[model samples]
Target: MQEITDETELRELIGEPLPRAWEKERTSLHELDRAWLAASPFCLLATAGADGSCDVSPKGDPAGYTLVLDEGTIAIPERPGNRRVDSLRNILTNPHVGSIHLIPGRGDTLRINGRARLVRDAPFFDDMVVKGHRPVLAIVVEVEQVFHHCSKAFLRSQLWQPETWAPQAVPPRAVLAQTLERPDATLSDLEDYYGPSYADGLYRGQ
Candidate 1:
């Protein structure tokens, strides 16, 4: 098999994108883009380290959890989790980030590519409180390129189809955690940790 090493041959194989595809990207948010952010409860935050390694972390909250500071800037609150802070650490050395916002049951997504920075505190933190807990830090993104991504991927995967879902096709969370992440912990312990009460601490922590 021949390896395609250069953009010239790749372009020849895939052909150029349509004019509209090139023109659709906006450097800032539009009214519809604001609407999408308001409705999206989840997004994937992508980052690359100085060493070129990449990571994508999932961020989610109630719908409209994200705060759009302006047409060209946005802020995402940091939620308590495992505290790896992998994405935030990457942003320190490589400020570039890519985000894709998704609404439940929607195939289409809103994409943002931009430079990011970590903020320790902001007046807007008060606006982001949930369950009486305010975010201790936030990731602020300066909008570089924004666009509405097409739905072909979701449509092909049937991601939103309830009938197509088989959640139990894989081992449940507690089982996986016990087997893969905490071998010393009993399965019973892991189950209690990940059960219904797990969500109670979502917005309250040190």
Candidate 2:
């Protein structure tokens, strides 16, 4: 394996960025950018802690789940998940965050880099309510840079093609739970707890 750690060596191997790439970037959102976001149903949220550890979380909702407050700002309703809150915890110590928004069957992705803050404003939460359930918290991002990423990777992988997909093949949740160091829990107990709640659409409101 080659171990090239320095910037000069990496730059030589990667060469210059395409000149057109720079043209796609903007300091704020425009009409087309808004259109892309409005159609996107999912995104990857990236954050880093002050100690430099990083985390990437998947966020999804109905189309336009992430609200565009303005040209330079957007708000993402924090849906309920595992309750680990790693991303939110990271934002507290390091405000900088990045997001990659994706639309089904779209080759290009929209990328936004920004400063984020966790918010609990009631009016904002009300605006994000779905099915009569509002999120307890939301992450507001002050957009700094936005751009469209090219589609070579998505095209080559045929990501949106059903023929290229595979069924999920992971351990059962209960089995994985047994691996954790919980002396009072067992596999059957874990299944009894998670199975029904999951089947009941526990993930619906967030």
Among all candidates shown, the one with the greatest lDDT: 1
Clashes of 2: 0
Off by over 4 Å in 2: 172-206
lDDT of each: 0.95, 0.88
TM-score each candidate.
0.97, 0.87
Clashing pairs for model 2 are none
Q: Candidate 1 on 1-206: residue-level lDDT in tens? A: 99999999999999999999989999999989999999999999999999999999999999999899999999999999888889999999999999999999889999999999999998999999988888989999999999998899999999999999999999999999888899999999888988999888888742
Return the lDDT, model 1, position 58.
98
Per-residue alpha-carbon lDDT of candidate 2 for residues 1-206, written as tens digits (9 for 90 to 100): 99999999998999878888787778899999899888989999999999999999999888988899989999998987878999999999999999999999989899999999999885767677776667888999999999998899899999999988864576777776778655479778887876767645534532
Clashing residue pairs for model 1: none
